[model samples]
Target: MATYIISSFRNHNKHVTYTSLISTSVNHTQILEEFHKFQYMQTKVFVVHGSPSISSRLFSMAKDVGMMSEGYTWIVTSKTTNFLKFMDSKAIESMQGAVGFKSYFPKSSKFHGLKHFMGLKEVDYDGMWAYDAVYALAMAVERLQTKKHVTKLALLDHILRTTFRGLGGEFKFVNERTLLRPIEVKNVIGKGDKRVGFSIVNGEFVKKMGKTNSSTNNGLEHIVFPGGHTSILNHRRLQVNGKKMRILVPVFGGFKNILQMVVDPKTNLSNVSGFCGDVFNVAFNVLNHKVDIEFVPYLFEEGRTFNDLIDKVYYKEFDAAVGDITITSNRSRYVDFTLPYSDMGVGTLVRNADKSIWIFLSPLNADLWFTSAGFFLFLGFVIWVIEHRTNEEFQGSTTQQIGTTLWFAFSTLVYAHREKLESNLSRFVVTVWVFVVLVLTSSYTATLSSLLTVQQIALKGGSVQFQGISPVKAAVYNNVKLNEDVLVELRSADDYAKALRNGRVGAIIDEILYIKSVLALYSRHEFSLVATSSTTNGFGFVFQKGSTLAKDISTQIAKLREDGTLKALEDKWLERQSSIMSNDFPAVSPNILNLYGLRGLFLISGVSMAFALLVSMVYLAREKCQGRSKMEMLRRVSKICPTPSTCTR
Candidate 1:
């Protein structure tokens, strides 16, 4: 029985060093022919493997083993064949040779083989024997277990002189880069459980199903070659078989482009003159060439300002701008533009607090009604008191009842209270009063509820901070005019205002409403708005003309637009009162996104309304009970007093 182990590694790019170094090793055909020419009696070689880095480590072990010594015939076996077939063959034939098998790993590439059914799909690993050989050598040394002060050279002698069983087979020392291991061949069991004869050790067939121990009674059955270190098996048991080209896309950004910022390393675009839609459409088409896109962002950095980044005709200084770029007549002379994706719109941004429900429920709004109710009740009390003072006939009548009844009407509206009466006429009055009180209570509650609802809706909608901002002005100020106008890019709104005041830039062109509001808020820095013939310069990609890639991309973009996909993206971003850059500004120091800002305002308002209602109900109920009890007690005491006719003045 003759067996040889082989493995090899080479650069994927097929570098020259790889070819030169790997060429020295034996090929699969040469290895097979050598095996056929076997002149030796029962022999087996367990090959070791390591990549570029691991190969160096194996070389160190070989030096200590003296495999490279002058007297030794150093025959480094590099046969790239699967030795399993030699172990398995009845006459010595086992497995197929394959190359580039690392592709079978789970992450890199995927493959399905016959062994996959046994749960061994991604079992491919590198440098297996370089490490495994160390284990086999360690086991052999453990078997000796001698404490006779063994030196490195003596230990090397001990290993090379003994034999033992190891993971590969019968562990025995050969020359450098080679290990003689006894092979164990088992019968081939068919998928149906039919078994055939197989080799027991080193390619020799043996039938033994009982317990077998590799260790002998005297010592271990495997020995290590102390002077020899294993080599990194580069050539594996495989052939190239085929070749194909594949396109690869590395991940550039995170979180699906949700936070594509102007200052970010990737997607840094120049000012382009286009509405938000056109700029983003061009950018998306360029980045993603897929025909069918599930989602797309509406506003991107390319259209962030009105600047043209791409050059169609050609210039010397720069090529194109990715973010918003100024599109001017000069720019048109040099560059081309794609069809407009969406028109720009100027809109308002309102604060959430201004439209909150609490704002409408404020005391100021209800003050007039409360005051009217109080004044009427006061007038009725004063009239009843004056009538009692001036008319003798009216003195006998219950002026107290009139005052109390009138006051109760006031309390009922502002607070919840009812009056108690004794006379039959008073009883009739009280019944009517209760009915009127219920109706008034329901009306006030309903009105308050509706007002609160409207306030809530308004708050949710938010107050427009800036109204009707002109994109044309923004284009001019952002230097989107390019060579047509001498304008500087304003990093921030404040900077633009400063430039306007300092007369550094001709005019601060921006969305008009935002500038107006900003100016109003600042009180300094005033500039005149420069009006221009606004051309709806849509943002577009600047690709080499007649390129097939460009054509394919344009088709995909058109499909996205036709199916309302682009519109959906627009609705997602443009409908918002503020842009992403606007919300991210440092003024407010919002710890989280603006979405949290809106939602938090609603949550606080709802909680406050609920709390206020609870307090108001408690206060109203207590006041009502106290006023009625005090009035009834006074009436009872008056009835028990001395007769009015005989009482002293």
Candidate 2:
């Protein structure tokens, strides 16, 4: 902008009487002291850059230079308007009646915009410029994407040719330079600049002021100057200096990266880093001003809250507080808040229950398992005892006899035993044993079904409860219907893990996002998410009630959101949030097969084998005592165990 103005001056009509370069503050002072040298020159209007010192010097000698009078006019560039906020009273005094340029931005309607989302009322010039630049670049890329061997040069060429009606106006390049929109001329009035004129690329000011010579001086009427004087000064100017800014931010937990207090260990001076701080830096940069910001952590010296933080701004205790402070109606009543940069509402988090190693064994109760084994042996022994004396097929050595007895008993469970029962007693026992086996199998299936379905779990009986928070509300939000009776008050966050691990709680539920962060941080540990709840309002920066910075910062945040920077920021941290939620465990019947479940049946089988062995020994001993031949022994056995029909007769 300065080069453009200087070039125009150099190419002016060649009969120039003189040229002046008041470059430095010292030089400006010299020119003001020696104003008489150029006082009578034909060129009365001085087209200069925005220099506070130069403007200060001009104001200091307004009478000598006839600066406030109608004959002399200063046409300055945009740099002067940027320092309007930081300009001292004296600097502003020097700026009286001075017409300065600022990039002009036309406004338009938007939807779900900064104002609606973050609470920003409007977008600034830089925001519009950024919007146009992004839009143009996006169009260029879209056009180039279809081509082969797309290169940066081609992209740049396409961008220069791109035309879009952006927020700032028509975005186009001319003379190999991006075309600048009309620049606004803020007339230096009493302590403020009012939009009195505007200059387009044609370098002609469109006058809006009602005073005279609006045609010559950028084709505008007249402008008001400092000291409430119109085109005239009282020959009085005050000297002033600018000061550094002090910014207040809160030091609290819960919202980590959004805002955090980081004090230098060596200097012990407070500093800050986070999304809030980063966005603030960007906002100021866009404002085209360098502010020496001294970040002061709001030292509450006691437990503080969003309300307390807002109150500090209201009371003028600090310039502004920056953090993930929520902007709510209650908070708004006390202090002003910028537009919200994030979504509204809160959610829940729950610790994933650790899996049990022996969970596979839970299907059947221990008694049922043991009893099934007992029945196995009982059925085995019954058949062996009933058939041993009557049939040769049951006749075997002690070990073989025992093996047969156990095999037949267990085999009956699957209806796979090959040997037929010779005696009616054995057949009756077999039939009953088969029925028992069917009952046991059916019972196991039903028990497993109930366990896996969990259709009737007691919420309160096993749920991890939160202390200092309404368990009923938490449960309701997390989709667990429970009253106080079902809620277990926790001592701390750790208690949730402990109670869940120890089987003291059925489910653990809490703030969902926080739990996700914790789970991500502790990804090595086993955890699970039960559910996330209804939306809770979002967090935002706090400010003194009605603070413009709140609006300004919120506006920048909104821009960031519009450009998808907010989504990127979320993705930045969210990507680090890994999940350890595992569903690899196979679902086995709670009545899973185990040694303990079958121990009772095996024990009964051992005892039955022993009883059979004793009977065999008794029979052998009796035969020996009888001192009879094989035929005699056979005759005695036949009499005791005849055919079923014979026995019935």
Candidate 3:
């Protein structure tokens, strides 16, 4: 059975680590110590092949070493699982959540009758095999008795050729030595076991154990692993045989909150702690098995880059590299990277706009402001023309009339105008005008409020610069279409702040991860994220090419994202620093509303005013022609149309 298991693993290109225990010579402490040594390798699966007594001892030791937990798997061979019914309750409890292989046989009426004859409630595989062996021998001896001369050789030949339907299926031998039997895969539950699937002759899982004979291939049904977990455990490869994995961490001095390495003087061991470190540690802890790791700090020397740190992983000098390493296409050619754990994009950080007294007019562009003013004046004139002859409010002096008109036009902005209209035409005009004013006022108020509370940033057509150790930063800068001569490069987060504040650089452009680090140091009121271009992938952990650990850790990162752990970590570290810059302040321009947007409102107001003026003129002309002839009425209408010369007078 052990050889078969080894061969199966070899077929799949998986490495197998084997160990043996002698029941007579190996003590309990020695076996436990051996299990303890395996912990350093982060072995997630274990296959046990031995007698029931030896398997029980191995399971007990495994539970002691903490291997029989949610993330671990234990598989026992038929030698032990076949006799699980006879094992004690203690031994059975220790093997809970274990997967086992047992010999399979179709039960028949004759098998039940034999059990009843023996007065036994249950019969194990061993008892069934013994019964079949005795029956075969008895039949062979009876056939030999019929022979004239019987010898030991003749008796053996008869036994070998014997074939019959026995309690344990067909009593037949294959190749004169091995039995042709199928194996049933079972999982240990509370003091018992349940069949999960079946393994055929080629070690392939062919069927699931259920009412439906659904065929399966290469895998079993859902398994309840240790701790009653239904999710499959992640299978990770060992970096070194039972040794602590060497991990390289960058010793960043500027953005310590992003990635930092500190050493303890007493123990002389490096301790990695920062936003990146915490994220990596959280993802590592949720893996199927814990790997022992040693953090070695790599101090950034002159001209050293993040690529150098990744090269160490590529060359096998370190098992992995954990930091704020940006995943780029160029770097990905030589090393593998886990899924990004941070926000992805390139952001432009610039100085906040200064508070101006004319900030209220900043929400709408000049064209919109002028268009709105013209509509207001036109509506005021239409109302005055419609009501001046009938309403006393419009019958004042020329100066008073002009003042009233202007007041009415602007008062509609706040819905505080108290003028009453006597004519239906005037009322219609005012109603439509009031609706237009309401919409304009609401939009203006909302925009002005946002501008007042949140600091706005305007990226003028100025020189752009980026600061980072990644070679991809240059590619991102070129993608933004900035002139090479105007590009300035800085080193640390402090440099970015100083350049932006002192007017050394107009705008600093980099990934959102590094831009956020700058925002954390300074007040958000002074600096703001102006624009974001999603031109680059985000930050990720680096590993050697084709390393399985990279895939395993990437899976864990995806889980963290789904379960909200990644967001919680972000809030704990990065979000708290820039909480003032919440969702209210998005990376958009303050001049959002324009003349084109309010064209519909202006059109409605203009049509209403023009209709009011036409109706008012027709009413006045009719009033004048009430007691006159057609010729006199025509003369009066002609008189109403003043000449250009009379206008000068």
Candidate 4:
């Protein structure tokens, strides 16, 4: 029967568990006390199966222990309820408000006659079954009397085949020997019981005969369960010792916008409000069960950490801990945590540096700048060699030629040069160089624009600071590599800003959520988040170790995240403080252009210049060979490439 109940629940996608409390020698009080050790909030429905004496005592003990309350349910099997008539009135009274199942037999003239013969006003199901067994044996004997054989085997065969409508509903064999009938679902009332429904052959409930008013969806009539409640009890109304659940929240000096506790002067009641509070409220609203909660604030002291706050839950001082509590491995050993609703990571908040006078050169590093300058000089020499003999623009003294060459090379950056090309070799070199210049100029412009618009800072080999109250500060120290002497502890956002402004600390290291709160509190433009490390889990609600409420609330938190409620809460509580900040200054630094990023463009330009120089040299060699006299060719070349001394004469 227990297996059937479990399977039926599983078929409907509902979880069910069966616990056996049957002890051979233990007293009823010991068994009941042992059962009380299980969490009532976790397990609601309990099915009791035993003889009438033991079950009656257990039912009375359950009522005394407050288990027969609004959030609990007690059920009994036919083993106890089938013989309820033999028990006294006190035993029946103790079973009040309990639901039980018993073998059902329809009322007929034969049933009444059997009850009258037994001299009893009411006959229980066991009495009816005995009457049906006697009637079936009589029918089998009559059938065998017609046959010549009176053997034991022949009598058993006749009994198996016999069918009749006796005191019981149907006195017939199904599947060769077993009789099947419906079971009545009864609610224990004043002195008797009420027929609420019937469990048919398939273990499904059907309304009692001639009853159309059903209170529950399971086709059962109105049931007065334990605690005299007419409606069904779900698991959500769990209480701690029959009172509201007490939750501990941290009331500290820093990051109050994330979590804060305020006391009303008149009422002396504490109210919690902030991003963490809003998240908890939203998650609680969507929970499957209803749980009353009370918020108790733990005043922060110098040496007390969040670990101490979580320890309160472990020691049973509070049912749970909720606030901006980080989930860490050390704390997880003592308590369970819900899924993190905030963003994870440690952020580095540093003061924005003043813009430098030479900010134009900030886009490219030294390697890229030096490489570009060298390529400019090389391309100028190559073009001059190719055009020196043929083009009049190239005919000049050494100083004049040097000035013109450098002018032509650098002018390609703006595409503004007066010199005209006479050789295709020189034009081809210029064309390729111009393309390379175009790519370099465009990259420089984009990178420089980002630097000018966004605040830039550096934080290498400088002192760091963090909130001393944060439990994850040690993790931040290990990730960012801070020394004992160089670490500064601050308590508030204003202190963080003051320390950075006066150069007391180079960077402030903390969780991303706390860093964001600091940015929102002050002028976000003055401070920027430059670096981040994913070293710790974000903030979550805390519960006692092995508490099922933690898992239930975690499921609700996930749903809130998926539906965007969590984001809306963040914007309302956290993002609104920094409404003046724009999307231009993100939480990370912009990428800087380097020599490695433009290596291919420089490679293409170098190859083109080399090819042009080779072609020009080969053409000049052929022309010199075609000249009639070597002296005449020499005179021509000397006139084109005059020395600085000759140009002065």
- Choose the strongest candidate by TM-score: 4
Query: Candidate 1, residues 289-379: lDDT per residue as tens digits?
Result: 3332222122324343222223221321121223233234444544444444433222212221234455433322354445435434643
Q: On residues 1-649, what C-alpha lDDT tens digit does candidate 2 reach at each position?
A: 5566555655762122234666664665577555654442223445556465565665567644555555355666776674565577876766567777777765544422534666766555566677778889999889887788998888888988888777666677887674857777788777877887776665566764223334664476567643344553211111012233556776544345555778789987777766656655665566554445578776445555446666666665555676656556666666666766654433333444344576445676676567667767766766776688777767879998888888887877678898776765456556655665675677667776656543222243455454333223443545545555666655344555566567777765444434444454444344445344444445566654434356666777788888987666654544444343322321222334555655554454545455555665676688777766777888887888777677667
TM, every model: 0.24, 0.37, 0.54, 0.67
| Candidate no. 1 TM-score | 0.24
- The stretch of ten residues in a row with the least summed lDDT in candidate 4 is 576-585
- Model 2: weakest 10-residue lDDT segment is 233-242
- Model 2 score (lDDT): 0.58
In candidate 2 the C-alpha lDDT for residue 605 amounts to: 51
Predicted candidate 3 versus true structure: per-residue lDDT over 339-449, tens digit per residue? 998877677788886789998898888999999888888888887888777788877899999888889888888888888878888878888988988888889988998
Quote model 4's TM-score.
0.67
Query: Alpha carbon lDDT of residue 354, candidate 2?
Result: 40
Residue 103 CA displacement from its true place in model 4, Å: 9.4
The residue-level lDDT of candidate 1 at 271 comes to: 22
TM-score ranking of the models: 4, 3, 2, 1
How far off is residue 61 in model 4, in Å? 1.3
